[model samples]
Target: MDEMPFCVHDVLNRPLFQRAIVLAGAQGIYREVRWVHILEIIHAAPYVSKHDLILTTGLWLKRSAKSGLEYMRQIIEHQTAGLCIEFGTTVDEIPDQIIDLCDSYDFPLILFRQPVRFEEITQDIHAHIINQHFGLLKKLEQFSQQQQQLILQSTDIPAILRLLQSYSEHQILYLSRIEANTYFPPLPEEMREAINTFCNQQMKHSDQIQEMELWKMDEHRYVLIQPVVCFGQVFSYVGMLLHQAHPTEYMKLLVDYTSKAVATVLLRTQFLEEKILSNQNELIQDILNRSIDSEEQAQMRMGLPSPNGEKYIFVGGIIEFEHNVIEAGPERMESRNQDVLVLIRSLLKRDRMHHVLMMKNNQIYLLCAKARIGKDSESSLYHKIQGLIDGLNKYINQAWPHFHFHIGFGKSRTMLLDAWMSFKEAFQVIELSQTVPAMKQNHYYASIGVYQLLHAVPYPILSDFVQDQLGDLIAYENKHHLHLIDTLAMYFKCMGSKGETAKRLFIHRQTLYNRLDKISDILGEDYFQPQRRHCLEMAMLGYPLIESYHADQ
Candidate 1:
């Protein structure tokens, strides 16, 4: 971070010097230097500016002891960098009294021990300072250009802010103009409120903040605010805080680059955000592919658990749209997909859900975390995930009225190493949900009832198994046009309760008894036996796929 400005300490360390010795006031080494000037005349403070370094031969000091003392005092009063006297030109040695005076004042006094070319020394020193200044400008230029390219390449805003922080090595805080929120190392309540107040007062100009002003909170800490302006108004502001009394020239350049980067991002917000989403989706796929190596790597990729000390439980959600948004041609499908993604993101953001979501294989895969609520009980977690999915379904239904969403979640309280497993399980829940015609929406792997085990069977095998178990009944129903299959499905669903099954079927008890007899005759008298009932339930769960299989054949 550019905490302090260029000082005499920097000049003393330059490679151009022959032998430079500090005589007195070494404590004032931190005194900033604006320019190096040759001051030969006596009482030269009037001509010198603040932080100017005076290089003289001490010929003027040869006049009298009092005059030299007065001249030294003047230099100290004006806050010049220091005195550098070449002894060989006129006076041989610096008087002990003068050195003592400088020491008393804590002023910097330097002695050039050898015969050196003053012209070469002055020019070289100035050139070094200018080069350092230009070097900082070059860095700022490169940073701005790099960030501009990043925007073009669709880097996320938060990632861009992090990159800027890396470049400046300063604490960066981006205040959203719209939300009135802070991002990238978000601050505490008291500090955030104070900063927001300061920014609101400073950013009075709608067009642009006139300059980068260093707002000092104390001797050791300060902030530089640079507004990101668009068109004729300020869209947002970036603050760079450093542990310095004043900011350096280089720090000013950095603040400018930050604001420029922010402006660039704001200008192309849609493209950059979409790009980031697409990239995150790709990252999820890579993680699903088990490409990540460690927890640290996963954290870096995920960027979850907000900076505000938010604890998270990872739950994976799979989105299933009842309507075929994809059948509307590739371009239209892509447009609808983007719209759906936007809707999903908006809803999540509104609810303050921290999530990484992506569309893959015609389903939206989400690894989401809500604030850890109560104990991490499986039921609590499941309900929370269900609630999130339910919210999404509601919003999706509202936005795309014709389309309904069936969302299934996997295990909760999982970490990134186990995220792929959670996603796989959640995806399985969605797939198996097809066989479980009873569970159309908001299903979780652990809560999907009997279908959880049936999910283990391969689809074709499960279809065949269902056919073998229920094929006779299906054939009997088809041949006779009787409502026997429906009656039996309802019978098993009511758990062999004659009264409940009769009530559910809205049939007389005798009619239900007669249907039960017919089902028992076809499947066998052991239909309600424990072992047979288990297979029969599995087959009934797989009935939809079996029917679809026969239809396709």
Candidate 2:
């Protein structure tokens, strides 16, 4: 039911003239003879369609010699398949101008002897066009089969690059991060400068400028740059610098496939690591509960050998009210460790007196100096611990904003089991202090012993009472522009020092005092009074308990 397709070559190859024999009636030179029109002919121009088998004689030729040539030039410009000139017409000779135009334009110009009928060539011309279409379809099918196989069998990145190079005729290809960094391999000086400028400007303005390409780098090379985003983070970039004049449609398809494959590989690897880590975390917790010979023996069982006689335990946790803001995948966690570990180690190194330190999960354990009872060294050690925690908090606040950190430190213990007990107590205090209003803003509360008797009390009784007292203030602070609740919390943390709180908040001293006075007036309590400050601090610490109870209800 489909119509026949047309081809320029098939039309050119059509036999327009019949061979003449004196004896018999003229024999047909081909199975059919069809009329061919030249679009340049004045009368024929209007009737010509895009792919018409145009037919014409030189009837429109003018007296001037230049006219014949200009006529042929016009016909060629129209992209006609071929021109047929009848020798028996008013123009007995084919003009040189016509011949020259046909040659220059690479157009077919066929000559017909007298008495050739154009109608005979139509059927045979249509049949030839159909055959060419079948041939093209077969080639496309073979190519598709080959490409599918290539995609399935390939694993090596270089091998895939080579395959793409051979297929696309492009020489250069590379993967880069969306977050361009100094550690990346150097680029051409000019290109490097441009990219650096672009990155710096983009950081100041917006993060939306994701990817770009450098075109016209050289006559022989074409470039493509694409952004790679993994797990909702812009991770890297994949670039291709091809030594080809231009890219083809197939090359684009290959690039898309390769990018997706790389993402899949990265995702799978992260999942595997997390699966292993989760198992190990459970195993470590089990070991902690069991009675181990010594902390050194525990380390050995955990595949970590202790180097010195001392040990310390640090417990920390990330608090996120909304889990979606936090990235839980293993790859994200590992990436975060790059900056966090540096901060932790830097803090530990600043106190060079501490002998050994080890990081386990969110907690850091250190084997620090021991104090004799008479030396009053416990107070000094407490100060050092407070300083370390404060430094960590400051670093984390600037580097990561969405999450808050809670740190718990335990004193050094001789036995591994004793260290485990200290770590457990510290972790429990961290949990309990979240419920108690009085201890909330206090960084280190030494009143609670290594046993967590406070944590056993139901949080609701304390939480509800505090919430009832502070509910309106909390709601108003959360609703309006000013952050009164955080201000109160920070004020208590700085030991009611207005200047210190102002410095921490990056506000003027007078501004902090004004806000504190306003808070005092609204709550009908003096801001400077120790009793009021203690009550507010306790209320803030008990917020987590209030939140938990509300959630359960």
Candidate 3:
């Protein structure tokens, strides 16, 4: 005989309740267990039904002494296990009427202090309930193990269908995928109507998962579907219609394992069939690759047509995987390819002027659409690119982490291949920008265009120019601890006016003149010399470049 299953009573005996009782002492309520039973708390009469315990504060009795007695009478009529009234709130004394009612009903009543809060008690109760549930799961698992083994070993589909029919009273259909085609077997008229409605709804909403439910046909009526995929290809779907409510957890686990076994069997069958078909399609792969290459050549030939001497600009980028990031694993690569292709297609469809292509090597090539420019054309194009980048980042970030994009825009060209040539130049420039000391040190926009050009110029040549023209003055000012560079820059900015320079620096005019005279003596040249002023101004503007050089070294 099966053992009588454990229930909440087993939970009440656990150590968690003892801990709660200890904690409650800290709140000044010393609790003594009277009786624990299930009772209904959310009912009109507040009657005890199947709950574990009932707790109350005597304040209700204190407000209307007679009603308090009547309240106890109602509780007794409900066959409650026990009652607890905390002390020091409403009723300081237990009235004889309440005691008499409790005595007649044989209900256990206990009293405690005000320190215990109801919240702590609820925690202990839930902990006990969860413990009881886990215990029940263990017992069910032990009983279902043998039945699960039989289900996996069985091969008779008809027998399995009969078993499913007995388990549920609802209309059930088996769904399977074969060679990427979804199949649904014949169903009862009512079930077919429901499924058609569900399929139509699914087709209308791309954002929702495809699922449906049918009810009120019979007791335990429901449907289950299982999808089978092997080697990244879906082959068949198996479904069942039931006439009964769903099974218990143990039974559900058995069904799931059985479904997986069936999927494995079907996969083996498909593999044998594919082996026979492969010999007939020996040249298929070669043909597909050649076709793709031909299409690419055609598109390249038509690139950016010139309209009556109008020119077009081109931009291109290669997405590089970061160090140690393997984004092209077989599973993820397929999905990524699909996603990027869809994105490019959508962008082209939305803007007819734009032409975009995805290369075999995963490089994205784009042509900047040519149009007769009005006043706001450049600004509109810039804003459009900014919005596109923001949208692309949002979509791509969902699948890949740290998706870095390097983009280069080319000058307008009338020839088709000229656009491709511009893309190549921009690509080279981006690469060169990565090497410059200043660009590398800053890291942000290190691969940008103008900064790349500035860095490409020989640093020693620029440095020599500054030193040869202003060496003596620069050295003297450095030795004397004067901000000669800043003073000179500001002085010239003020148009050689002493007072304005002093005001800008928040120093007195005399102080400015004194620094200027020291500057003249150090350089052994006139402070008013135009050549000296010109050299100093150039040096100040080149400060950032100089800093970049030093950082690289």
Candidate 4:
């Protein structure tokens, strides 16, 4: 602290100024002395300034005791550091009235035991003050170097705070607005409450306040707050609390410097995090798009476990964010995304799962190693993939209950080269489920049944196939306003049971038989043969897609 050099008590502790004794104002002994000034006239108070330690021979005050009292008041009014009265010249001894005035004002009054040259006193005190300033500057330089080293070594905030606390010798509390928590050296319950309350009130006023300020929480404690600002916004605050009601100017300076260092660390950390996230997203996109030419290249880019001919299952999940929720604001979406990422990463790490997770086009994709734990079962991969999906969904729902989110998993692939197919399968399952009402949550490729195969077939091929098999009946039904196609489908569904087909169609047996006779005339008698019937049934299974395609045409 520069305090020792600029203090009246420390000045007296020096050998050259040791002859000085306090006549009154003992309570003000610790007043800081900024400069030493010689005062020979009674009207010198006008020229005095704060922290100026006055040296005098009491030449004017001896002429009138009443003026001595007035001079003390003037000294106190100007907030001078202290008054030193030389006892050997002009005045024999200090006046009782002057002493009382000094005590009342809490002003420091010193009695010089012997004759002391004003030039000598000023020279010595000013030299000490300069040395004190130089020492503080040196210390500040060292602190800057140390902080730079610490930042380069690690980006841990707690470690940084611990170092800063040692240098400051004061209790420190770091409140992160981004993390929504207080960190660093722990605080007492009462102290934490007081700081939290103060922060809340300040945020209510303006969250962008970046300046340092002091608050006297009580007679024994004072808090200094220095905000960590980035891009004209305050993201956190570093607060210092001391037992003294008023801390030294030097201590305040240290606090400001530490807060600035904290801000630098935060900005650097954020930049690195963003850079890493971007790289991860790019790698994930490359993998899912089949742009990654080789598994070796993937391992090099992500430092992930090498596939090395190992199998992996690609699980893609999409949150069809409600338009209203998205329209609400970007902040809400950003918060939710962060929560999801954190949860997924945590779960992945906890389970020691070899996985890659990233966000692409507002959807999250996960790729996990498909290594079997023991004897592989039909449902082992399903259970594994389902567990990850359920865990992520549960956490997300817990965090944001008002929002609706659905998750889907895909089939496992035996080769890394087929990862892109797995990703597409998972994505398609999600799209199909949401598009088709019959699809359920947690939908997967296997659960999609024949619809999966129908989707794989091109719309033109499926339409041509449908036309080749059922074109005549479809044309007849369209021309006559009769549902021969429906009747045929029901007949096929009921395995050609006349009574069952009629019952399912809500028609009489006579009506079904008549429709079947017309269908036979359009398709020929050979249509009901085993091979032709199989082809017709296959086309029937894909009829919906084929019909939709023809309608669009």
Q: Which candidate is the best by TM-score?
A: 4
Tens digit per residue, CA lDDT, model 4, 220-328:
7666778877645466788777665556667777777777777788778767766776887787788767787777566556544544554344344444444245464
Better of 2 and 3 by lDDT: 2
Residue 98's C-alpha lDDT in candidate 2?
64
Native-to-model Cα distance after best TM-score fit, residue 164 in candidate 4, in Å: 2.4
TM-score for model 1?
Answer: 0.48
For candidate 2, report its TM-score: 0.37
What TM-score, computed on C-alpha atoms, does each candidate reach?
A: 0.48, 0.37, 0.33, 0.51
Task: Give the Cα error of residue 133 in candidate 4, in Å.
Answer: 2.4
Per-residue C-alpha lDDT of model 1 across residues 1-553, encoded as one tens digit per residue: 5577888788788775548888898988888987889889996867998889889889878898899998988888888888888877787888888989988877889888766677887898788788888887788778877887877787467777887788878778786533455645766789878777766665543335545666676677677777777553455677888886657867777778767777777667656676788778876887789887776567666775442333456777787655464566666666666666765665566556678888865688888765556675445556555555666666556546776556677877546666788888887777656644667653777777666666666778897887888889988988986688788778778888899999988889999888888898999999888888878777877786556546657
Candidate 1 regions with alpha-carbon error over 4 angstroms: 1-267, 305-312, 322-332, 370-374, 377-384, 459-468, 495-497, 548-553
Q: Which ten residues in a row have the lowest lDDT in candidate 3?
A: 22-31
Q: Is candidate 1 or candidate 2 better by TM-score?
A: 1
Candidate 4, residue 173: Cα displacement in angstroms equals 3.2
Residue 118 alpha-carbon offset, candidate 3, angstroms: 29
Task: Report the Cα lDDT for candidate 1.
Answer: 0.74
RMSD after Cα superposition, model 3: 18.1
Each model's lDDT: 0.74, 0.52, 0.49, 0.72
> Listing every candidate in turn, what is its Cα RMSD in Å to the true structure after a full C-alpha superposition?
18.9, 14.9, 18.1, 12.6
